[model samples]
Structure formats: C-alpha cells, structure tokens
Target: MNKTVIIKGMSCRHCAMRVEKALNKINGVEASVDLESRTAKLNLTNSISNQQIIEVIDGVGYEVVEIIDV
Candidate 1:
C-alpha cells in the first residue's frame, strides 16, 4: 500500500529527515520525504489506517494536512 501525506512545519532538510525517520520506524512503513514539497510517500507492508498515519506525523511534531492513496 502507498500513501502520500501533506505535512506542515517542514522547512528544512533536517525536518524532513526527522519526519522520515519517525515514519520509517513504524512497522511496515517504507518512507521518503521531500522537503521542497513538504510531503511524505509511504509504502506499507500491511494495512494501516489514516488516523494511524496522522498520529505518526503528529508524534513527530508535524501537522498532517492530508493523506492520499496513490
């Protein structure tokens, strides 16, 4: 499964890395973060809900503006 999440407060490469690391640590998550676009693309090995994704974002001190399947 794939997901695209729009994130807020990502102003630099460091912020992107932090978010990427946070997401990647979750079981079943493969993640890539784009600082320019402030977005994260995640590939999951199993089912995960929107709320769970949002929680991950929030847990890392970012706000999730949206999540899309692609």
Candidate 2:
C-alpha cells in the first residue's frame, strides 16, 4: 500500500530528510519526503495504521496535516 502524507514545518531538504529518516525507521516502511510540497510519500510493505505514521512524524517535530491513499 502507498500513502501520501501532508506534513507541516518542513522548510528545507534537511527537514524533509529528518522526516524521511524517522519514517523509514519503521519496519516495512519506505518514505520519501518532498520539501517543496511539505509532504511525504510512503510505500508500505506491511500493514500500518495512520496514527502510527502520524506518531512517527509528530515525534520528529512536524505536524501531520492529512493522510490519503494513493
């Protein structure tokens, strides 16, 4: 499954990278963050909950605006 997550508080590539790294830490999660869009595109190799994803991103100091299947 794939999901596009709209995030806030990412201003540069480094910030995006941080979010990506944090998310990618989860088992079976592949994350690519786009600084320009303030969004993270996630590819899930296993089932995961939206709240779980939200916690990871928020834990890294960003706000999760929304998540949608893509």
RMSD of each: 0.7, 0.6
Clashes of each: 0, 0
Which stretches of model 2 miss by more than 4 angstroms? none
The worst-scoring run of ten residues by lDDT in candidate 2 lies at: 8-17
Candidate 2 has a TM-score of 0.97
Which 10-residue window of candidate 1 scores lowest in summed lDDT? 46-55
Q: Candidate 2, residues 1-70: lDDT per residue as tens digits?
A: 9999999899888999999999999999999999998889999999999999999999999999999999
TM-score of each: 0.95, 0.97
What lDDT score belongs to each candidate, Candidate 1 first?
0.93, 0.95
Q: How many residue-pair clashes does candidate 1 contain?
A: 0
- Point to the candidate with the largest TM-score: 2
